[model samples]
Target: MQITFWGAARTVTGSCFLLEHEGHKFLVDCGMFQGNKALKQRNYSDFPFNPAEIDFVLLTHAHIDHSGLLPKLCKHGFKGNIWATEGTVDLCSVMLPDSAHIQESEVEQKNRRLLRAGQPTIEPIYTMEDAAKTLTLFKGIKYHQLVKPAENIEVVFYDAGHILGSSVIQIKYTEAGHEQIVVFSGDLGRYEHYILHDPDNIEKADYLVMESTYGIRFHEEEKSKEDLAKIINDTFKRGGNVIIPAFAVDRCQDIIMHLNSLVEAGLMKQGSIYVDSPLSVKATDIFCDHPEYFDEDTKALAEKYGTCPLKTKNIIFSETTEDSIALNKVKSGAIIISASGMADAGRIKHHLRHNLWRPESTVLFVGYQAEGTLGRRLVNGEKIVRIHGEEIDVKAQIVALDGYSAHGDQTEMLKWLSNIKEKPQNIFLVHGEESAMGQFAEIISQKTGIATLIPEMGESYKLNDLAHFVEKQKLAIDESGDMMELYLDINQQISQMMRAKEWQKLFDIKEFLHKIS
Candidate 1:
């Protein structure tokens, strides 16, 4: 048995992992690379392994970073079933097509500039047809139900409490006449979250693959209803709009619930609230359909309101491009929530472009801003920024309330790990930056006295050979002169050249290498 870290190693996005047992190969996430251009460019690269060779994909959730690349996988010849929770399946039904639309739209916009310059146009990573086809292959499984995706493999999903229907996947399989169990913590959520249930507990596993997104940080104390009211009331008094960049799925709904409470309590005056992303509007409706997934507090709020917790008298669902554009005309007393929580893509950018230069306007960020993302730039206090080719000054009030983050904090993550009665033989950390991974690895070692490994991108590990495992070595390369080693070296160099945009030098190197060969 072997496992490969294909993505989400030393980074926060693109969460794919490959597991092989008994001649069967399957994936854990198959997510897309997000944030910086170098990472996003990976979306256009070929799969490290042939997608058609993959037996199945065990999806953890419907978050774009976790499931955005499914259509791309399908477009690249993957034709296997994708097993996920029923809620995840339903969310993907809307989210995948929305992601495809964004891809197409971004490519189209880029092509227009290329056309004017007489340059070659580029295609989207995947089209809506590919997304539609990918959806047809979904096989919904209920939480906690054990199912077999391949021979000698049994899989079960536990509530991760991150986003709606997110899961911690457990896999039990036998290899070389011995049984082994692997548990993957797929973005564990905070305890006592507003809408979702707490993360489920597990007691045993031979090996564990965990996420450390917040390993070195702790979230701020939860704000009271009054705090939200204060921000809104203050912004309104300044004759400015509160533009919030929230995720379309859960965060948007959570913010709406808070706003509804504030209004009902008379803490803030009733005002117009525009949901600018069409995807967010659709996701809000989906959130309404899954009342069973809500916690007692959220359910009670819904009952008290006698309607969906996300709905209010003053709320407006902006479903059309014109309607979204019209929102930029509003000067004050409007709470505008848009998708792409990071504010890197979607209508959020348009709203920011128009409002960011106004001193009275407020831009509230309610999610994690990845390194090198536009959201991070604004959050980090960049004085000036360019949006849609227009340079804009950063004059608006920027605030980040990380209490609204879906991912749990460092203490919460440690508590989740400490719950397992028997510590695993090895804990492999992924889905985090280098600094966080290093810090968390040390903390886990000191607290649990268990060994931990921080795998790098494209790193592989042989699970059956415990004693021979060498951390940070390329997989299956036993000698310095091996063909596989040379191939990996060449691939690494080519990737570096591509990232550096050294097209001519890259071609010359390739030609020289071919001649030498």
Candidate 2:
């Protein structure tokens, strides 16, 4: 068996992995590229392998970064079944079509400009019809249930506690008469996540493919309700609206629950709170329908409230374009929550265009912002930004509450790893920035004494000869004369040392390099 790191190798988005065994090819995730223009442009690039050749796909969740490319995969002639949890299937039912709409809308807007400039027109990556067809291939599996999507491979799902029906997948396969177990940690969630259950603990695995999205950070312990209330109150006092860009699936519902609690506690004044994303409205309904997936606290909260956990007193769901446009009339005392958490697209951009330049308003971020995203630029304190091709000065207050993050932080991820009684033979970290992946590799190596590999994009590993594969990789890089590769490798080593605070070792390495030069 062989594995390839097609995406999310040294970045936080575009999570695709290819597994080939005994002439059969399968995919773990067919995610879309997001964040910076370089990464986003990758979405339009041809697949490294022919999508038509893929036998099946093991979908872990419905997040766009994990499952967004199913339509494109289907459009490219993949006729295989896509296996996922029931909740994931339901979420994708709405999300995929919505994603297609966004793509179409964006392409249409870009085409107008190109038409005027006499440039070639572009097409959307996939259409709504493609998304609809992709849904026909979905085969829903219940949590903890085992199934085989291909010969000699058995798969099981564990609740990942990330979103409504997110999962950690385990694949049991046979290679050369040897049985092996490989576990994929599909965006593990926090232990005390408000809506979902804690991530399930796996007892054993031979190989582990884990995510390291927050590998170098920890979630803030401070309760975000107080901070949110203060931001709202302060903004309202100045007669401005609080515009929030949130993820439609998990973060949006989480924010709604928090706002409901604040209102119930009388900590927030009663005012119009608009959920402006149609995708979010549908996602919230799906979330409410699956009460079985909720944590104990969330279930109890639902019981106490006598309604959905997300339904607050002053909440308004705006489903139509006109209704969304009407929100612009409310200049102050309104809390507008929109989708596309990174604020790169969707109605949130329109909302930002109206309020981001207002000194009295505030733009609150309740999720992780990938590098080069609009949210990252705002959070990083860029004074001027462009929205809808118009440059706007950023006068509004920008705030990020890390406590609302859905991904488990470094400490929580380590705790999750400790659950495996026996360490895996190899641990590969993906879905993180280069620096975070480097820092995490060191921490995992020290804690478990297991070999950890951070595979670069297009890198491959043979499952049967893991040690030899790693040694070959080390030799290849060590023997290479490419200055840029050497420089990056040295920088990663220095970063790891700095993170460990080993000043002596860092100084010694720098001095040794200087002497050798």
Candidate 3:
């Protein structure tokens, strides 16, 4: 048996781990590649392994970066069951179809631009039919339920507390009288979050895969709530709207909970909080549907409300296109929360187009902004950006609430890692940037005496071999009984170009690479 870093080796998105044993293949988190133009283009690339041969998928969460590719997987002919927590499956029901719509819409938009430019039209990765088909493959299992998906393999799900129904997948496989337990930390959620339960800690694992998105940083918890209220109050006082680009999953509901608290405490004014994304509106309902997944405080609050704790008295749900369009007309004394937390797509783009140019308005970010995303550009203080193909000057205050991140920070991750009764032989860090992973690997080594391993993209390490790793110099293909060499030269060329571009200081490098790649 061996494990390969199929995706999310040194980057923060696109998490997949390929495990092969006894001529059988399985995967954990066959996620979509997100972030930069290069990374997003990888979504259009062929699968590293034949989709038909894969036995099963162990899903960790419903975040697009982690679960977005299921439709494409199904589209490509994978008919295996996808095991996930109940929350994840529920979220995916709406999310996957929404993703398909985005894919079709984006491709259509691109095709229109290409048509005028006399360029070739492109195709979407998958369609609504594909997403609908993918939904059928999902098998919802309760957390902590011992699942025997296949012979010699046992799977269990633990709450990661990252989002509603997010899980840390634990897999135990016995082969040749030897048993190995491997745990995949999908995405660790913060402790004492207002809505979700804390991440569940495991006692032990033979080999571990962990996420390190916040490995090098700690959240600034002090005064964030106060700061949030202050920001909203100040924006409303200035006769402007508070525009928040948030993910529709847990972040949207969490922000609503905060808004509800603010309203209940009389911290916020009697202004409207518009949830402009239908997906968010649906997700909020889903949250209410699964109050069993809520934390103690949230559960109590939910029971008290008898509705959804995610709902606020002053909040409005924008369900229709007309409702969403009407929100753009609200100039002041309103808080508009939209989806595509990165502000790269969905109704958030329209909200930003209208509000980002207004000096009185504020665009607040409450989640991690991946590199090369519009949200990152805004947070990095880009003065002007193009939305809907028009350049808009950014005069609004761009605020990032440091404490609102769903992921746990370094200290929390360490605390969770320390709970293991016995230290694992090796620790493999994935789902983080290269620098963060480096610092975290060093920290783990120094603090716990465990040899931390950082696997590069497409790299593989045999389960029995601790000291050696096989780099993907031969090809970029994942294991499918035998390694295949198809995109080696092209991928190598692209990798070289990316490295060279990184080493050089070029202001137009992003646009240049995007155009060519």
For each candidate, the alpha-carbon lDDT, in order, equals: 0.87, 0.88, 0.86
Those runs of model 3 whose alpha carbons end farther than 4 Å from true positions after fitting are: 222-224, 465-468, 471-517
Off by over 4 Å in 2: 465-517
Clashing residue pairs found in predicted model 1 = none
Cα lDDT of model 3 by residue, 150-234, tens digit: 8888999998999989998888887567888888999999888878888897977878899999999999873555667899999
Q: After superposition, how far is residue 498 of candidate 1 from its true place, in Å?
A: 26
Best by TM-score: 3
Candidate 1 structure quality by residue, lDDT tens digits, 1-517: 6888988998989999988777899999989889876677777767878899999999999998899999999999999999999889999999999899999998887667556655566778899999999999999988899999887899999999998889999999887788788999999999998788999998787888999999999999868888888988889999999999999998998888778778878998777888989889988888888887788998997898798787767689999999998888999999999978888888999999989999898999998899988899999999899888678999999999989888999999999998987678889999898877998999999999888998887778888635125344342312221222234446766897999999999889989989999
Top-lDDT structure, candidate number: 2
Model 1: CA > 4 A from native: 465-517
* lDDT of each residue in 1-517, candidate 2, tens digit only: 7888888888888899888888889999999989875577677666778899999999999999999888999999999999999999999999999999988897787667556655566678889999999999999989999898888999999999999899999999997788888889989999987889999989788899999999999888846567678889999999999999999999999888888888888889777788999999999999998998999999998899798878756689999999999998889999999988999989999999999999999999989999989999999999999888688999999988888899999999999999988678999999999987988999999999989999888888888845235221111211222222334446767887999999999889889989999
* Candidate 2 whole-model C-alpha lDDT, 0 to 1: 0.88
